[model samples]
Target: VTAVIENTAGQGTNMGFAFEQLAEIISQVEDKSRVGVCIDTCHTFTAGYDLRTKVVFDQTFAKFHEVIGWHYLRGIHLNDSKKELATRVDRHNSIGQGFLGMEIFEVLMNDPHFDQMPIILETPDDTLWSDEIRLLYSLIR
Candidate 1:
């Protein structure tokens, strides 16, 4: 099995939390070429990297590309943030109820580059997994 380092940034000093730090760590590693990122929307949004608006999305993603390269974006955690951008709080709400709405999801789904990647939902509705999953699928599909 291969170990990929995923960091949590914002509010504290975490390796993968900041795009620059994550990319820097990846660059210095011996397995730099093989290292990638698993960007959790909640973490990214909480870390002050807004993904809701196209401008913010483009700028944040551009940073990712410039630093780590898109090839290193191994996966995604498809979570919506309950807090505002740069709040540095990592609360995840259900699919569309959070601050980041369906539009961002549409963009993610339409992204051909990330098509082959895996996205996981870490919503807190444990008892409503079926409902939450269905809602997420409907939004993405």
Candidate 2:
């Protein structure tokens, strides 16, 4: 089973705000081989791990690898944030139309590390789903 970690947004006693927390949870699970993680882009960004730039993206993923290992990465919740980096807000916006911008998604879509992993859209606007899906597909190299 894959566990999707959520951002606390400075809310009441919420865990999984950091990658390490998720790692710890996975470590405690008895059936470790069957467990994995699903990272949400917006939550990750708002939690202070930047993915908007190539350098930052590399650094962020490196940190994740160090804390949780790449093998534990099962999927991605692909969403742009409505808040700026490190705000700890859990708001979602349409692709290329929020604080995360389009570059991050472009980089992620083209990255081989996430090649076969499922990337899900959590954008707020239902009317823009078609455009968002098309935009993400267009980023693939």
Candidate 3:
């Protein structure tokens, strides 16, 4: 089953805000057995959750577990952050080039659980998306 919703574009609302809120709602459902999360890195960062550091990663993942456990994380959009933590900015830089850097992405890509999930890039400059994808792919084992 799929949960289709409108793209997040509203005043005072960050990209991932809807997703985060959706996660919360999904958590309350009596039958969440098939529920999962689709994380767009740009949106994730825009929502003020930094995935650049191990500490941040742990915290973010922890919050996901608290708000909506790991069983719900179904997909991921691998994009880089264009702004700092809590900036509420929605700019998406090419992978490895933004504030998130390549190191953290490499780590996430190597993670056993997350590595199996589909990671699509929503980064801009479509002409260079392939190159960015290749760059991120290279970081994985």
Candidate 4:
């Protein structure tokens, strides 16, 4: 079984807020393939990895690939943040209903890089999960 370490919102003294820290932690592992990383969209944005626009998404993910190799990516948590960018808060909102607009989600749904990864929805409202899933699926074009 693969053990996936997820990125966090970097609230207060949190350590996994940045890809650099995650890279450092991941680098220590003796068996690189045994463990992997799961990126949380909300946490990533709150930590300052911008995904508001395509260019920003490209830049942030490029940095992530540089710091933490793509071979170690296992999953993705698709969430919208209630807080603003670089806020270091972990508040989650419904998809396309928070600080992160719908465009990013639409782009992400179509991004081939995440095709094989397990995509999980972590919206604040559980009742909206079905709708969110449909919305995400509709973005795949």
Candidate 5:
């Protein structure tokens, strides 16, 4: 099953808040192909991984690859955060309306890694899913 990491909101008791935790879990599994991750944009940002600019996006994802390995990435949850970076609070906001802005969404919309994966939207407004989907598709280069 794919292990979706949860944000700790600057707390310490939780184990899956970090990518390293997922890596550790994967390391213990005998059938490596059975394990994978689905990164939530809001959670990852609030957990302290930045995806703002292309440079920082590369760096943050490089770190993710280093710790968790890209092969284990099975899916993505696209949600902008109502909270700021490193605040650790998990709050879902509509795409482009929160602090995450639009560049990161544009980047991910065009990223090859996400092209084949399931991208679930966690935006607050269900009525806007159609518009959001169109907007996201428009971001593709």
Candidate 6:
């Protein structure tokens, strides 16, 4: 079974706000090989990990790799945050319509590291799902 680590909005002594915490949690599991991580973009951004730029994105993932290792990266919750970077607020908006913008999504879509991982959308607008999906697919190249 995979252990999907979610970042908290700093609501009240909540845990998993940092990648290190997720690494520690996964490390404590007896069978580490069976465990994996699900990175939610909005939560991560809310937790203060900036992914808007390539340099920052690489740095953030580098930290994740340093702490948790890339083998445990199993999935991604592809959502944009309504709050600004490091706001510690868990608000998800539609793709390209939030603080995260569309650049990061395009970068992720083309990144070979996440090639086969499932990228799920958690945007608030149900009406824009089709359009969002198409936009994501179009960025695959």
Off by over 4 Å in 5: 1-12
Model 5, CA-based lDDT = 0.83
Give per-residue CA lDDT, model 1, range 1-141, as digits (tens).
334666463655544678778877776878666666788888888787878966778888988888778878888888787888778777888877798887777777767777788877778777766886776567555
**Clashing pairs in model 2, backbone N/Cα/C closer than 3 A:** none
- Model 3: what TM-score? 0.81
Model 6: lDDT of residue 128: 96
User: What's each prediction's clash count?
Assistant: 2, 0, 2, 0, 1, 0
lDDT of 3 by residue, 10-67 (tens): 2274333654676656756676665567776666665667678777877777876777
Model 2 TM-score is: 0.92
- Among all candidates shown, the one with the greatest lDDT: 4
- lDDT scores of the candidates, listed in order: 0.76, 0.84, 0.69, 0.91, 0.83, 0.86
**Root-mean-square deviation of candidate 3:** 2.9
Please give, for residues 44-124, the per-residue lDDT of candidate 2 as tens digits. 898889999888999999999999999888888889989999888788888988888888998999999989988888889
Error of 1 at 66 (Å): 1.1
TM-score of 6: 0.94
TM-scores of all predicted structures: 0.86, 0.92, 0.81, 0.97, 0.91, 0.94
RMSD of candidate 5 to the truth, in angstroms, is 1.9
Error of 1 at 16 (Å): 2.7
Superposed model 6: Cα runs more than 4 Å off = none
Supply candidate 6's per-residue lDDT for 30: 93
Reference-based TM-score, model 5: 0.91
